[model samples]
Target: MARPVQTPAEVLGIEPAGAYHRLLLRAPGVAEAVLPGHFVTLAIGGRDSATPLRRAFSVHRADPVADTIELVFAEHGRGTRALARHRPGDTVDLVGPLGTPFPVADAPETAVLVAGGYGSAPMFSLAEAILARGGRVGFVLGAATADRLFGVAAARALTPHVAVVTDDGSYGARGRATDPLAAMIRAVGATVVHSCGPMPMLRAVTDVAVAAGARSHTAVEEAMACGFGVCMSCVLPVAGADGATRLVRSCTEGPVFDGTTVRWPEASPPEPSPSVEPREVREVREVWEVREVREGVRS
Candidate 1:
């Protein structure tokens, strides 16, 4: 059965690190059903405005005994920035424990988790669940710089096999996370790969895992208005069971999906805009004028 949405949750505490923040909330109903990889939509200020209707954030931690749920989010846009203004003992409206979770391995298996930026939020709980079931786990985290890499130290506490990658060589590897991830999968022979990041990165991980003959799953992020299935705003194209392409709701059906089932399109060259003239045509007159000027100067 679906859990009821809880609004007006009391803020238990606030913890800030770099650009990211963790808000611990006490809401009895939410604490019961929240699982790893599940998310909640928070309505800031209890307002009905379009900007702050509800913002979805992953469940960083859930303690049923204490009736508390923790949400770790980066201050990205308007809604999140507003959420950052909140302090302890304040009330915030929320709705959730929504979306399908990553498939739990039925047996002992090697699992690799890859995350980019704040995408790491959902994987912590997943790692804990896997560890409890005696599953072997490893992690690969990627960020633009070391300062942006949140939760790497905490993740290391759970597993020793953690690799950090930064784009500008500020921390670990001087390349994207996909580079080390592919290397790790090859060396460790991971049985299953789970990833959450930007679409391009997720696509790259999917390709690498597929080529290596490893089963993989991905958590996709998209614009979601309503956390429930009613809004239909978070639809994404997916291959149906009949091999035909159809749109699926990212909110209800999944934020997590099998990588193999997704259809990736072939790369194509950039198309010129209809309103813009050809570059060669524009450069021809400029070249003629430059040559005339050069001849005049010589004379």
Candidate 2:
């Protein structure tokens, strides 16, 4: 992994992506270093705004040739709304390719990827990486509605084995993404599963993967006040290799972890100040109409 660098990255473009926005930036160093599941933090609200905190976003895509990176997010709060206001050629302070990346298998194998809403951002690149390694990939994507679900076309372009679900039945099925997960794993004889989404969905994915005896990797959507692991706001009690549960920072030690090892919370905790990971509880329940974010942008 490469060390992170803080730079004043120039905005290359911003466009509407269904209910979300896709931001592109000229971030050579960050873009070059970022891998699947790695994220970046952006200082929001400008230099003299009320919200001084940064927002984190998972990397949607990084183009080393173009020296650019792309991020997908919903402008539901003050910070993101401010970020959405940025125009091409504008500059934003960026820090990243931070956090642990999703570990890819050294040898090609059958795999499945699960994503919810914009959480699908990181999964596409991950799929490409897996495919490049001669691995087979399948995708399970879900959202509240068809409009909210992302990357179906992209996923299809990657592989024919794609399943889509929506809460209201406006898409493939009227259910959560996890609904068909087990069957997908069984169908493909997948040995590995990867996911990026709200906390609850990740927990469910872990359960299904574990039940199917597949190794699972999940990129958590925890709110981070500091993307460098200093604020301690993104800690989650995770079971370590020795069977002891310890609080781990999502920004540093993970954003991606062994799904079977996470100690899932009994109940949804209070939605953290909206900072990074757009597919959290707030978006699931409220549809991202109104919310405040905290740590810098991830994607």
Specify the highest-TM-score model's number. Answer: 2
Shift in Å, residue 9, candidate 1: 1.1
Taking every candidate in turn, the Cα RMSD to the unseen true structure, in Å, is: 12.0, 6.3
Q: List the residue pairs that clash in candidate 1.
A: none
Q: List the candidate 1 regions with Cα displacement exceeding 4 Å.
A: 1-4, 48-52, 264-299
Query: Can you write out model 2's per-residue Cα lDDT over 1-299, one digit (the tens) per residue?
Result: 34899999999999998889999999967787889999999997567866666899999999998989999999867789889999999999999999999998778988999999999999989999999999999999999988898899999999989999999998898999999999999888899899999889999999999899999999998767668878676766777889977767778989999988887762135444654554434434432221112111111
Q: Give TM per candidate.
A: 0.85, 0.89
Give the clash count for each candidate. 0, 21
Displacement of residue 40 (Cα, Å) in model 1 is 0.4
Question: Scored by CA lDDT, what does every candidate get?
Answer: 0.76, 0.85
